[model samples]
Target: MLTISAKEMKDVLYELFKKYEFTESKANLLAEVFTQNTLYGVNSHGINRVPYFIETVKKGIVKVNEEAKKIEAFGNIERWDGNQGPGIINAVTCTNRAIALAKKDGMGLVALRNTNHWMRGGYYGWQAAKENCIAILFTNTQPNMPAWGGKESRIGNNPFVVSIPRKEGHIVLDMALSQFSFGKINNYKLKGEQLPYHGGWDEDHKLSKNPENILKTEQGLPIGYWKGSAFSIVLDMLATLLSAGNSTYKIGLKEHETAISQVYLCIYPEIFHDQDLQHTLINEIINYTHDVTPSEKGERTYYPGERAANAEKHNSKNGMKVNKEIWQKVLSLL
Candidate 1:
């Protein structure tokens, strides 16, 4: 592992993105987004994904200098075509647009079609929450995870994220329908550690904690067996319906995962509830959870986003620890 300050890492990445011909503002934003993810301990969607992003852009799977174009609008709901733009930038733009609409109408929904992979879905959640809005964001990926009771890959993992505002720290839940993402499995494999639970099935049709076996089979377990699978199906339907974008089924046909769909919703809770009432209610609920007795000694309690906020603080102060090989790979780009 290599430890580099957040500023240094982001600056290097910014230079690399600029070298790729991204505009200064876009390059800077994307670099900071990646750096922030690492600082929050979300390495799978952060620096680890950078190499692939470059390759995709180089191959024209992801467009350069393209902007999301608004396609339709009705009341507080709007649809945009990504024009195959950079995912991180497109997601940020959509989230901000949602925030703007929520500021006016008390709520907003934006569905984006033909976008590249957004890298980290939670970034947009945090983006909205930071602006004092409650946000929900999700995206459909390539058909990678298999449906429950099936050995063949027939469903998308479908990352989902939700965030709520709070005085102490925002509450965020970032999850994939699948028990583990392939990027996460590769991370664990690199570390030579077994998954804490059965993440997927092996070719022998047995549940396994071994990342290698799970990767080979591409038979990742859903979060709750059939329930998560059903949830994924519904999410895909909604994404396709709202964005008029390609579904996982269609995306799978091209044997590529570009031109994905995403949805962002933002609510101005303060418009309906006063600040005091909002803070009091959120505090009471969080306090109740924190007051619970730990089942084991030395166990600590945390609310959503609490651990990640702490990680950001610690990493920003000390430095982010990154995979040495990955850092070298990125450095070679310079």
Candidate 2:
């Protein structure tokens, strides 16, 4: 483990992306997106994934210069083709587009097709919340987790995010359908630590907390067992249908994980109610949640995004903690 300042990480990433032929503006955006995600304590999708992203570019899975284009539009809903662009750029564009439409029409839906991984889904949620908009975002990945009661990977973990704006801090829920994401499992393995609970089955077909075993078996457990499996299926269906793009099964046929679907939905609160009243209602709910008794003494309850917000503040003042090897790898790219 090592502490690296945000500026250092961003500078190196910017240089690396520029070397990969991204325009100066695009490189800067990529640097900010990746660095901000790391500062928000999602290193798995931030610095940890940079090497993989670069590899995807090298393999032509992510086309560096391609940009998303509007394909169709009806009412406040629109469909766009990513043109196999960098996922972070495509996702940011769609998020901003949805926010713009929602501001004008109370709500907006942007269905995006052929995008690669969007890194941290929470980034877009926070983006919308910062603009005083509520957002729900969804993206389907390659078939990486097994459906309940079935062996072998059959369903995508399918990241989901919901965010509400608040004066104090945004209320955000960002989660994968799996009991544990592969990134998290890999992190624990890197630290030589076991998962706190059973995360998946081992080759012997029994629940295990061992990260190595879970990674080997590729049998990550669903969040609520059968319920999560069903949720993953429906979210994938919705993304595919809305974007008119590849579903999990179709993505599995590709040489690698690419050309996936995503949906960004945004709602403007001021259009529905008084902004001040909306803030009060949000604060009341969050305060009520915080007022609950802690399950353990000396522990405090927190809302969904509170910890991440705190992390961002703390990491900005103090350097972010990053894996030494991963940081070195990123530096080597420079």
Candidate 3:
């Protein structure tokens, strides 16, 4: 492992993106998001994924210069076509647009179609929450998990995010339907570490923490067994129908995962006029959860976003730790 300062990392990524034909602004935005993902301890979507993103760009799968376009608008709701633009740029634009609409109305909705992988959905959640708005975001991926009863892959690990604003640290929940993302499992494998909890089944159909087997089978367990499976189906349905875009099952048929669907929602507190009450309620919930008796000595409970935020602070100050080989690979690209 090696540590790289955030500025240095961002500069390297920016230069690389620019060299690949991204506009200066777009390159900066992409670099910033990737850097922040690493800082937040989401290397699976950060530096670890950069090489793949560059490869996609080189393959012309992700158009470097394309921009999303508004397809339609109805009051507080709008629809847009990503036109196969880089997912990070499209997602950030849509989230900002949703926030703007929410500022005028009580809430806003933006359904996006034909986008690529957003890479860490929580980035947009935190973006909205930071502006003192509640948000819900959803994205569908290529089929990577099987339906509850079936064997072959037929559903996405579709990730969803929810966030509530707070003066201290906004409460955010960013999770996928799968127990562990393929990126996460691969990261653990690369680090020669076992998953902290059961993540998927082995070839023999037994629960296993070995990521290699999970990757080979491409059959990840959902977070809550059947419940998560059901949620994944519903989320894929909603994104597809609402955006009038391809579902995970449809995307799986393509050569690569692109032109996917997503939705962003934002709610402003001013419309509710109960800011204090909302904060109090959130505090009560968080405190109650932490108040639970530890199942083991020295064990501590954490809310959804707490751990990520802690990781962000530590990594930002100490520098992001990267796999030595991967770092070298990225440098070689430059």
Clashes of each: 0, 0, 0
Residue 218 local lDDT, model 2: 76
Whole-model Cα lDDT of every candidate shown, in order: 0.91, 0.93, 0.91
Residue range 52-137, candidate 3, lDDT tens digits: 99998998889988888889999999999999999999999999999999999989999999999999999999999998989999
Q: Scored by Cα lDDT, where does model 3 land?
A: 0.91
Number of backbone clashes in candidate 3: 0
- Pairs that collide in candidate 3 are none
Output the lDDT of residue 35, model 3.
Answer: 93
Ranking by TM-score: 2, 1, 3
The model with the greatest TM-score is: 2
**Residue range 73-141, candidate 1, lDDT tens digits:** 999999999999999999999999999999999999999999998988888888999999999899998
Report per-prediction Cα RMSD to one decimal: 1.1, 1.0, 1.3
User: Local error of candidate 1 at 299, Å?
Assistant: 1.5
* Cα deviation of 13, candidate 2, in Å: 0.7
Better of 1 and 3 by lDDT: 3
